[model samples]
Target: MAVRYIPYYPDTLEGQARLDNFVRTSRMLFYKDNNQVKTRIQRGMPLYEVTESETVGANPDGNIVMHGECLSTCAYLKDKGIEIDLVYIDPPFASGADYAKKIYVRRNPLVQKAINEAEQQLDNSDMQEFEEKMYGDIWDKEHYLNWMYENLMAIKSVMSDTASIYVHLDYHIGHYVKILMDEIFGEENFRNEIVWCYYGPGSPGMRNFNRKHDTIFWYSKSEDYQFNDKDIRIPHDAKTLDNFKKGLDGSGFISENYDLDQNGKIPEDWWEMAIAGRFPKDGVKRVDYATEKPWALLERIINASSNEGMLVADFFGGSGVAAAVAHKLGRKFVHNDVNINSIQTARDRLVSAGAEFTMMEVRDGVRLFRNPVQTMEKLVRLIPGLNTETNLDKRFWAGSIYDSQKGKMPVYLPNLMDSSSRVMDKTEMNHIIREALPDLGNDVKQIVVYYIDVEDIEELRQFIHDENTQTDIAIELRDLKQVLDDVVIEDKATWEMSQVQVELFTKWQIKMLTFHSDYVMKKIEAFNLIGDQQHQKKLANNKKSTFKPIKISDEGLECIEWLSVDCTNAQKDAPWHSDAEVKIDKTGTVTVNGTKTRNLWDATIQSDDKPLRLKVRNICGDEVLFVL
Candidate 1:
């Protein structure tokens, strides 16, 4: 059997290796249990396939994913030659505390006290206390800055020559990220340290002053970057316009031969906009996500910074306000987040706002399109016992049918990414199933394909023929049932999985794997923390853990195969076997299946006074790794 493993190490390590690069046991591994692994793999597979199938387009060309890592977005979009126009990132405040959703009301004593004090001190009605608690002293400032800097580096490469980026932070990391942005986008393109004052208030008993504002650092790739100044003009109130008119001599309305009303005043750097809050008056139902930015704020920045049809990218999209506003205003937007729930919220918000798009598929080189939800459901129906939990289910739907459908018939399924598979409607599913049916035969009989693991093909055929030899064509379920009364279910084991067939299988597989991985990883981490010293040592003392081996999948194999055939940048970035070599103990050898690599761990060794720790270095940035 020809098998390929996704490389866990790079050919070379670039720059100095930091302890942070390793998957710290303290933090949950990306895929810990079979479930979590399955989810990541399954959810990720369809997306990966869809992305791989996309044709490269010049300018702002790329798919907008509602979920997944930020690095993946940069990698995906870059493959399509799509340099982003602007990236407005508002990542979680990185406070170690869990961010609870507000669906069920619960009070944090500390937060409550702070809010009360903020209310008492507010001298302006507009000044809200929410900001002071959430954005003010939330996280360790240094960690926020460092975490943000590392993530922003990935965003830096995706910017266009005429692009600009905005970093939304509070007094905490605003100034710090600003300095980092100055370094990244260049000091010359550092446009402004915009002060957004939601309120003008002061705490009466404070020693220094009361805080009532946030900051956004604007940076551009070049001095001649896109800034449609007129697009963000503030209409002078009737009085100011009248005053200007009066100053003009009458026909006279123009001492100079220029139209006055046509020109609006350029907005000042200090913007006084309403802070996003729970009140319905603020516009839209309040979403449950913490730190949701107001659409109005995004509107101002997007209008001033970019043009229509240009791409607007936001990686740290909490409620997807920026992406929602972007799509509403006719601009292409790509919003990314690691949290599935958050991305779903964004996608639903967009769908509700009436954006049109559909997932597509390409069967036998004939592209077909269908509704996203329907596509997912049809896939599930096709594969027996395969539900959304399987890794294969999502891949089968999203990769094959979804891609083909989106490319072929974009009309039926508008706006590809929808809510979770659980939320899809049956009506939508029916429409999608109808749309996705292969253009096989014209006789009205519904023919669905199945992929089973059984090895007896002749037995399966005989069983099917014996069972349903008298079946005939049918249109409706009622009609099908009439025909099925005489027909039999066929067994076609060992048949190749089609886009439709695989989509169904992959969904169930993905869910199962993700749940398994997440569960296992959490247990492993917890056990290491509280388990016996020897057990902890056993878990931690690894060149690579015995429990956690570097394993690659068939998808990974395909990516490597593509790389072998096509030396494209997209292929080069695919997860594959690592080619890098790191210094290791001559006595120790690390084994992955039949292959062995030098082991970095030793029985008796130290980096300085510390015991030998397995370290991985990537010389070439091609492989994806799992560390124990």
Candidate 2:
């Protein structure tokens, strides 16, 4: 279980003075959890490779794509003595906005529209496109500051002496973080506050000027750092070039022999580039992931800060534009994010660029909890006999179950959305005995506690034995993993493997005939129910409603987003080595093995080696591996 440590939030003037003095004296901010986090920083977080995934035309030294929290990830990097040269982190801005990814059903162009009025009439509810929340940015100011303090300290330890870091933020709480960055990186190392300007349609209501830009704070680790001044220069406009050539002053901006690099002039601290999805329906640079930065923005930062062979890292890497751009520019990269979508999207983008990297997780005992929010929502029905009928204290009991032998049993479940609560430790167990047990009603004969991870099973068992209760009520502990072992509804698939002669050469081909995701169907049904309710409300108000449920094409390929065949081995535990792969983007554009292909999926893949297994990723980024 993760140890509990409350961070020192400066809430008052005295508290602020204490924090600032601590920073001046210790050269680090105050975090009550610092010792716990520092232990991992000094040692390291346990990391294991999920799959090798790629090795084609990759750096010999290797690139890393990690899935975990930023502070823990930095700890692992620090323990390995891996010094990063450039770091760009676009972390949670504490903007009170919960960003979500737009999940779209793939369009199967090969299928013909079905003209079945009877079938359509039976299911009148519609399946509108849904957005899945990636992560919550809402937080108390104190809590947010505490979290950022620990992360900044951890990240700084792994940076090289000549490294540079860029912290991206906006007007929401950027001013507060600017002070923190000054304390962490030192005031002397403070460099430029880059203003990234962009534009969009304004709101209809009258208000002040629209806030349409983000702030990027760049700082260096030391007095001397890498800055490719010549490589990042901007091209001069036509008028400026004419003025220089005609020996005329450039409107008082240019003097005699005021020579700049022949390449271009040095750009100012401000940049004008639109955010992702702002482009004209994805002009080859837009990735569908939320808050994805433009490739050109990353390209400029990478070119200006680091050299070709140096390592670049992004801890809060959302869509992985930083890593992809780094790899494209002949630099090694390390990308880490807790969201599976971020990791999967970034991994696919890198693969599309023919870059290789090692995929790994921090081994938090949450193999299937990559998206814990949705998992928690599904737990209510998954657990047998569970109901929200707890007669006892609601604070401690999430729900209760009725058993013939045991009577009424209240159940306690950790909040899977919060990482801190997923684990069961000494402190949590002690609280259960002291606070929870006292609140239990007389009818409660038993109580069940579920934990995703634990500190020590034997110690916990002994703790229960040592602690006595005023009542004879029994307490039971169970491993949540055992209950959630079959949590993911596996997708059923049918395929044929045979030898096909193409261009006089016999090659093995695999054709996917049909596919079905039970999870996807259930999600559609849920959306249909909501649509039905909305339709009824509109009709009650005497408004005409044309509510049609979203229907899957007859081909049933709309649920799939990615497919790959691992020809190397059937070793399920090892890193996956894809012999052939295909992915469908938001626009239904199919890409085969890092190259753009036709607009529609061919439903077949060719491979030189015999296919060993198949990996299919649904539209929601949930994946299932099948033996071929």
Task: Give the TM-scores of the predictions, in the order they appear.
Answer: 0.42, 0.80
lDDT of 1 by residue, 87-173 (tens): 788765443544433211112223334556677432222211111011122345543444454456557667888888888777655
Worst 10 residues of 1 by lDDT: 507-516
Tens-digit lDDT track for model 2 on 1-628?
3332222212221222333345555466544433433343333333322334444443475799888777557656765678899999998888998788877876653541231323332121322367677777776665566567667766787889999999999998787678777777777788899999988888899498988999999999889988898888889889877777776654644676677457988889999987752322322355777788888788888999999989999999988889988987889999999889998888888887777788877665565544655566567777899998646576677788999988888888886644545557666777788778877668778889999877688898888878835667788998887778866567888888998988978878888777888777877777778989999999999999967776776557778889888888787765677888888765566888888874456577778788898888888787888887
- Model 1 whole-model lDDT (C-alpha atoms): 0.43
Count of steric clashes across candidates, in order: 74, 6
Model 2 CA deviation exceeding 4 Å by range: 1-59, 109-128, 236-263, 277-284, 379-423, 426-449, 457-478, 553-555, 586-589
